[model samples]
Structure formats: structure tokens, C-alpha cells
Target: MSTPTSTAAGTGQFSQRRGIRLGYQMPNFSHAASPRALFGSVIAQARAAEAAGFDAAFVMDHFYQLPGIGAATEPMLEAYTALGALATATERIQLSTLVTGNTYRNPAMLAKTVTTLDVISGGRAVLGIGAGWFELEHDAYGYEFGTFTQRFERLEEALQIIQPMLRGEHPSFEGEWYRTREALNEPRVRDDLPIMLGGGGERKTFALAARFADHLNIICNASDIPRKLDALHQRCAEIGRDPKTLETSFLVFGFIDADGDRARGLQRDLIERTEVEPQLDRHFVGDPDDVAEQIQRRVLDHGIDGVIVNMVGNGHEPGALESAGKALGPLVHRG
Candidate 1:
């Protein structure tokens, strides 16, 4: 779990005004050479992200292999457990599951876990939840992987139950799938731990975010951002909410390397390791300046508030983040 190193540069026009924030995800999943080895490496990487000035650090919550990532039974770490460890290890950066599956744990239990993590981490935690996807995980865990619609319904009810509880509201929920009665959460989170809703399901998921989440994270082709933003804005209006009130974030995957040849090579190695073709059109890659430029262009062109770069490059390259931030630092100030 690497910590983010920030320079206290004001969130200026480049990022802040546009709500530009930088976050990172640990690349310690199944692509690792060894889960044990990658565990320590990921911690160091988290520290590097902090050193390089990132807003938050996240870990993926998947019990099975994502289709493109190969076999379902690969070495995947549970997000909540990983988060507990990360909370103990890092000091400054906010910790969260990039997006956790609602079906994996009971809603009330999940709320308790987030509050516990918040208390342990001194209130620097974000609860990022999503309707469970990846059927393999559900099957492997012997949890029912129902229809997409059913899963989404479950996810919404989960929010109804968990959010209020986290917010210190004694929540009582009776839904089709889940039932809770006037349950009180002890030692409520110290800070206003914002809820982040993840998923690109335009109508349902986006509306849910507008209604409840403090942050909304979307992952899709870059070209799709404008359309989604428009829809999100529309949803905000429908919900009588201001579009600007919700923080927007993107999940970007790519590599950053200084040497042109080395960068390309690293990208290639990553593509192979992850067993998915590199989607550079939507990724950040190349030399530091190039990477920074791409991020700047994307942010301005699409009105993106911030980016959560999925650091999916080769092993323990400390300079990777530092150099990228240096290149991005100047651009970080541009409106």
C-alpha cells in the first residue's frame, strides 16, 4: 500500500476548478507475478502515488477473473480485507474500494465495515459500491448471480439501507431482497465519508448516483464521456440536484514511462500480462510530458473533474509516478 505524496499545490484551474482530482488503484491483482510479492509491491506503489501527489488510492473488488483477465479462479484479493490492511499502512491518502460488489457482503455488514475502516483510518475512507457484476465471482462464492435487473434492484436497496446508517440516520429498510429494522450503527464514521457509486449504466446507475452518491466514477471509452456527462447532467436536473455538486471521476488504465522505447515496451508487457490488448485510445501512456498532455487534453476536452489512473505498468518503478506528476504538475494549473 503506497501512500500519496502531495506538494500542497493548490487545486488550481487545471484540475480544481474542473473538479480535477488524481487518484490511483493498486495493480496488485491477478496480473501479479506472485500475489505475495505483489502485496508488498502494491504497498510501496501506494506510497509512491502519495509521494507523487494523488487524491485517493483504491483497490478493485473482484472475486473472480474479469473476462479479459483470463481464468476466473486466478489470484484475486478480497477488497474489504485489502482495505483493512491498507488503512493500517497508509497515513494521508483516502482509502476505498474502487467499487465493491453489493452482493458479496450483507448491506448492514458492509456499512459496519466501512465505518470501522473510517474509524481506524481516522475518517479518511470512501464507501464505493456498485451492483455486483462478474458472474463468476457470485458462482464461485455460492452466491446467487441473478438477472442484471435483479442485481441492480438489490444494489439500490443496499444504498437505501447503508447510506443513511453511515450518515448516522437510524435506518429501517424493508425491500424485496433485504430487510432491516431500525438498526443503529455504533461509533458512526468520524468524517462525512462520501459515498461513491460506480457503474456506467446510464439510466439506473447514473440516477442512483445523482440521488445519493457524493462521487460518481465511470469507466468507458473516452469518446463516451460527453454523452454520459450530458445524461448525468440531465439526471441531476431530474433529481433537483446540481450537476456540479457531484464529483466526477474516471477509471483510466495505462502506463507512464520516460523513455519512449521503454514506455512502449512496458505497455506491451502490461497488455500481455493482463492478457488484454492495450487500449491506448482511452489510456494514458508514453513519456511524462506526453502522458500529462494526454490527461490535460482529455480533462479539458471532456470536462472531466478528475482521473483515477489505474497504474497497470511493469513492477516497482518508483520514478514512474514522480516523473508523470512532474510532467503533469504544470498542466495541473491550467484551467
Candidate 2:
């Protein structure tokens, strides 16, 4: 098997120049007034992020809304379809799902889908993927939800097939879980479309990222970052790959408002509504300055390469993402 070329410099112009230091994630669509207004709201936020200097824009790839964010019946857009439309709607910001579940599509088909997105986006597509989780979605959508080890095994095999196809090579592989015979991917805007793995499993996820992903978006709580980074470094060492070659970022659930009190209130409401313990390490709820300070202290200071914030509470409101961008852009893009 041929080693896939490095995509560290091929995510897009923004990534090559600034390396995804600041990203906006749109995780909830319920804020849209009605079904007809959904895509418009998404476009508005994407444009705002681009205008506010965000390096990338992300959406969740799920058939149903995530548990903590909203009810399952709430609006959830198909990730690739949304991204394809976003490609025409915005100009600069890179577009992708925060992490695409590998179980949702076949490896070869997934390769072709993202390659099409890359061509449509004019080289601004990123293949952010992970081993499938969310058994509820799988059950509801009729995708097989296997045991934990099985899912990881499938992911490993899928990558074996995906990596070469992403590089325009026809790879033939026969694995217990998946098989591809000289699968072809043509019409790709660039061969090295970046693949970002999102998760914080110290063993499996990190090791796979070291071997296959150009970036690793750490998705665990903030307190776990140091340990996760250490694990990721160890994984790289095990494979004789430099840890520095894998760019890293942390996921933050933010609730930003100009008024600090209002931001706190919003956070409280979410906690009350979801009836779950607030994982403070993964959340930043405050005024712009407050959120930025928390991110700098908790995320950037830990040596993570970037921050991807999902402001589900108010991100759809006018100026919400802009305010976040204004505060976070400078912190992540320092000299």
C-alpha cells in the first residue's frame, strides 16, 4: 500500500496560512424560526463566521439532534448536503462536519462524497471522521451498531481503504468488515484533502490519528487535555511519527453574550433543561472577554493547536458568532 501524502498544507488557503486556529461549529438548528428558514439561518451564520475571521465552519453529522443539545425530534441537517450548499453560500471559511461517523457510509463512497465536496468548495473541504458512536442514531437509521471494539476495528479497516482513495489511488483491500477492489476517486480538487479525527480515546483514537489523520480534534473534557496530548504524543512515537506532524484542536461548547449575566443564565437554562451535570471543562459561558480568557487559560495554554467552539445556545442569533469570532480570533492567532 502506498503511504498517503501529507495534507497538512492542503486543507485550504486559510489552513495553509493560519492552520484552523479559530473555528465555528453549528450544532443546533432549532433556532431557525421555521423549516423554510433553516438553510437561510445556516447561511447567515456561515457568512458571519467567514466575515468575523473564523478559519473554518463545522456542523454535526447526525440524523437526529444530540441529546444534550436538543430533543431528537429537532432539526438536524445532513452534513454533506449542508456543506455542499455552504460551499456556494460562503467564500473563505473551510467547511466540514465536526466529525463524520464512519459507519454512516461505505469507505469508498465516503471518499467520493468528500472529494465532490472538495471540488465544489474549491479546495476548502476537510474529511473529519471518527469511529461511529450514538447507537440511538444507528438504531433509528438502521445502521449496524456493533460492539465498541468492533466499531474501532471497522474504522481501522475503513481508513486503510479511504486514505489511498483520498490520494487518487485505486486501492484493493479485503478486510473482515469492509472490502474494496481498486476503488477510484477522480475529480478531486487536491489529492491531500485533510482528514481530521475527532475523539480523545488515549489508545485507539490517538493511535489512529497518528497514523492516518492530519489533525486530531480532542473531544474530551478540558481537564483531560494534558493527559490526552501525552497519549497522542506516545502514539506518534510508537509509530515513528512526529507528534508535531498531527495538528490538534479542542472542542468547546460556548454560550456567549455581551452581557455576562445573560450568558450565565443561558448556561443555567441548558443545564436545567438537559438535566445533566455541566461539564465545565467543555463549556465556556460568559461575555466575549470572559469566554476568550477561559479558552486561553484552559485550551490554548495547554498547547493544543486550535479551538473549535459550538455556540448552540445563541450562535444563530444575529451577532452571536461575530462576537465570539471577535473575542477568540486574536487569542488563537497570536504571533
Candidate 3:
């Protein structure tokens, strides 16, 4: 349950040890899952994760589902509102979005919302920020989905403005996408509210995370891990920072099954559902022991400090979650 530490630059920010931080992605786009079911399921999942010893829980922030998912305007809950409800429901696990878009809300307001949620949750909130993606959702909702470069630029600016405000200062900023006066945020509940940036952008995003984020999330081809991590180190060095200061988190799209045949079948079904080729090399699947071993191997092999086992929505049925949580006990609890 406790976060283990490792030497940073050969100096200890934490003890020289690290452990897997188990996290579950609460399904927002799951076709078989509804808002009411999601709310209840999230509550249950959090409790289950806590009892099973997960480190945190996160939800998706989107008005609609990804294109392939049959439903167009499916039931979805706003991220911060659901977070407030989640705060009231859970006791210990940290809460956050997989990554809330900078385009969705004003940076100042989003920062304030997270700080408030952190306070309500007694400092267990993580603000995961990112450049908005999924053009369909933006276009349909009447929001401009600009070029990729523009979004990243906006995301960087948002972090620069919002982090300081959350840290108790009036932030003044002017940017191409967003502008703000010297605005002060009141009742800054949690001084250490962690600002996490998600993406695999090697240039701007990774560098910005090195400079600003408490944590960095890696979401990309599993083969890209070593190269991206190397880039992260380079960025930290460029910023005159110790690379070890930032926590590394990976998002895996996979499953866990006890029976080998059943595991392969589930994986096949998942691939069919998503219409995307399943990359077993990039995923964790098989029995509890097999999955656990894969996770541990990923940690040591990929230089990953923690992992967020993306249940991939309905792909993770009841028994699957149980297997993952129970089997992962060793790696998650290891120190």
C-alpha cells in the first residue's frame, strides 16, 4: 500500500526501493456499462481495489465514445463531477482522470476543481492533463480540433499557468489558444496536488513533463518504451533536473485469465470488439501467475516505475479483475 522509493541521482528522495502501483481504469465508454452502472461499479471497483490493495483509480473524460464503439451519444458522466462523487464514496485510493483535456475547460478552473477535489478527498487527487485528441468528439461537440502541434502547445501553456495557481499564486498568461489575467485561486486545499501529464510526445510534451509534472504517463507502442524513457532522461538533463525525480506510469491494454484457453479466447474477443489487432507483445494476458510474471518483467525490462492496467472497459469481466488484483499482489506489494 505504501509507495516504495529508489535513489535519485544516487541520492535518496525515497528509500532505495520501488513497487508496482496498481490502478484500474473506470469504464466510461463501455457499451454494456451505463452511467448508473458505472457510478455503482466504480464505487464497487474502488472498494475492491482498496481491499485488494490498488494504489489509485482513474476515469476517462469524454463526452462520447471512440468511433468503433457502436453507441454514438452514449451515457457519460463529466469527469470532475464524477470525481466529486468518487471522493465521497472512496476512503483511501487516489482518484484522477486518465487524462483530462486542456481544451475542455479553462486552465484556472480545472486547476481549482482538482484542488477542491483533492481537499474533499483529503489529498488523494491526481490531476492528469493532456492535449485533447479524438477529433470526432471535438468536431461533433462544436469544439475546434486543431492540428496536433497546436494542441500540444496549448497543453504546455495550460500546465505552465495552472500548476502555479494550484501551488498558491496568481498566474498571468497569454497564449495562442488560451489567455488569462493574474488570477488567484482561493482555498488552495492541497499544496502537493500532483500534476501529471499524459502522452508519448518525445519533444515538447515529454520535456514539459520533466520540467513541470510530478508524474509522467507513457501511452504508446510497447516497443517505444526504451526510446521514450531515454528521451525522458534527456529532457530531464536538458532542464537541469534529475530524471529519477519523475514517476513513470504505463498504460497497458490487456487482460488476465486463469485458464490458458479462456485467456486466448478473451483476447481474441477483445481484438474483435475493438477492431484493432491485439499485440500480445505489448499486452499482459494469461493466468494470474503468468500475468503477474509479465508485469514484473515489464517493470524490470521497461524501467517502468508503475503501471495502470487499463481494463479496456468490458474486456475485463468480474472474474478477470479478481485474477488481476489477486495475482498482482506480489509485484504491487513488493518493495
Candidate 4:
């Protein structure tokens, strides 16, 4: 457990306009290393990513390996704990889970948790979150797994508490799903710690992002980027907020290998093993050049501000981060 530093309160390190730039999401934790050695492997990856010009480093925020990623029994680290430790192991890269599930902890708990992370990391916390989506984990953890609409309702209620609390305000929120009596968050790092909302729901997600989020990680298909961005623009207009104020990025699943042929094989194996549909347009399964080209053509062409790529296959290799970065860094803006 980490404690917040009082001296850091109300002092944010970054602004929303700069955006995420380029991020590496650590999706594969299963290295050849043993359990005790696993974190060392992760540290190497994070250090490699930072050296490769990746601005942020992320891990999935799930108790179990996701259905398409790995088995439930596979080793999974509690996110904030890992991040607090990661804060010490690396410098420069922003540390956060891709998007935290809202159902796992109470709003005040989550708020205080992120605040503590910010304080520990010298103010590099990005509160990446979404309407809790993984139902199986919720059931396993005894968290309420409601219908999709119900979950969004809960998320809306949760944010009503989370947003104000992040700013060092003890909001007294009473919603159908949650009730807090002037919930207090102590030792906050900044009044404006960036809030990044993940997901691409037109009506529900964008509306909330337009209201409360500093950034929006678009999780929709590549082809849907144009339409979804347009919808985001409208959502901001509906709320009389400037869409530019809410930075945007697309979450791209990738398979980066120096050997194109071997990379293709790894891609096929990953898809087959996970039984998850490959985002053909959004995902790339080839060498670094291929990754860079696709991002420049598809992502930047559509006016997306930034791209967050998670290489689930061969990304844990020793020199993979450098190779992947060599290919993708030219197109990515570093601020």
C-alpha cells in the first residue's frame, strides 16, 4: 500500500491537449520467467518501452486474464499495487491500467487509490476507466454484474462521485447504485489529474466522456473511427463543450515481430487460442514497418490524435520494444 504526499496536492504534471502521444500496453505477462521472476520481465518491458519513446505504459485492469488473452487461473497482478511498484522501477512513462473496471472498488476507494498512485509516481497517473465490461470477473469477485444498460447506469452514478472526489472535493452523491456522504479523498496530487474514458458507445459513453473525461480511448473498429469521432464531436456540442478539449486516441491490438512470416504465424496462433475476432482493420500482424504504415494510413488519416498499441504476441521478446519503436516512433508525436 502506498500513501499520498501532501506536498503534491493540486499539482498536475501534464495537460490534456498534449494527449497520450504513443503508449505501450503490456498485454502478455507470461514470459519464460518463474513467478518471482515475472515482475522482473515486466520491469524490463516497461524500461524497454520507455527507452523506445513510448510515453505511457499500461497493463490490463482485470483480475483474470481476459477471455481472448489467457486463462482465468493465469497470473494476474492487482493493477494499482503493480503500478505503485512500477513507479519506482521506471521513469518518464505514464503508468496506469488500460482502463480500470468501475465495479471492482467503491468510488472513494478508487479515487483515493489513484490519488495515492499519483503521489507515489510524482504525478504521472492517468485515471483510465470505463463502464465495467467483464462480467465473468464481476461474478467471480462477487461484484454486481448487471445488464449493459444497468452497468452504464451504475457507471454514470459512480462518476458523479468519482469526478468531484478527484478534485479534492468531498462530494455528497446519492445515486440509485451508490451513496456517499461527503466522501473524502486525502492528499490528492492534482485538482486536474487527467481522466481518460475508454470505449466507443455513441449515446452513453461519448456523452459521459464529453462531460467528465479529459481523454477518450476509442475502442471501436478502425473503420468506425470516422463515425465515432463525429459522434464525439456532436456529444461535446450537445453539452456545449469543445470537442478538442477532450483528447482522443484509438486502442490498436497489434502483433509486432521483426520476421514478418513468423509474426503472421504468431498472429494466427493468438487468434485461434483466444477465439476472439481479430480487428483486421485496427490490428496489424506483421513487421514494424507494417505497424507504422497502418497507423499512419488508417489512424492518422482519420484525424485521430494518438494511438495506443498493445502487442500481445512476441512483444515480450528482449529487443522487441526497440524494433517496434523504430518502426512506429516516426509517426508518433512525443510531447
Best candidate per TM-score, number? 2
Per-residue lDDT over 124-184 for candidate 1, one digit per residue giving the tens place of the 0 to 100 score = 7888899988786787779988999988888877887777777676666667787777767
Candidates in order, TM-scores: namely: 0.87, 0.94, 0.87, 0.92
lDDT of 2 by residue, 117-154 (tens): 98998999998999989999999989999999989988
lDDT of 4: 0.81
**lDDT by residue for model 3 (20-127), tens:** 267777654454455556567666766777666777788778887554333456666688888898899889888899889888888878988898898888878888
Residue 267 miss distance in model 2 (angstroms) = 0.5
Positional deviation of residue 53's Cα in model 3 after best superposition, in angstroms = 1.0
Q: Which has the higher lDDT value, candidate number 2 or candidate number 4?
A: 2
Residue 42's lDDT within candidate 3 is 60
Q: After superposition, how far is residue 287 of candidate 4 from its true place, in Å?
A: 1.5
lDDT measured at residue 220 in model 2 versus the true structure, 0 to 100: 92
**Stronger candidate by lDDT (1 vs 4):** 4
Residue pairs with backbone atoms closer than 3 Å in model 3 (clashes): 5-17
Q: Specify the highest-lDDT model's number.
A: 2
Report lDDT (CA) for all predictions. Answer: 0.74, 0.86, 0.72, 0.81
lDDT of 4 at 302: 89
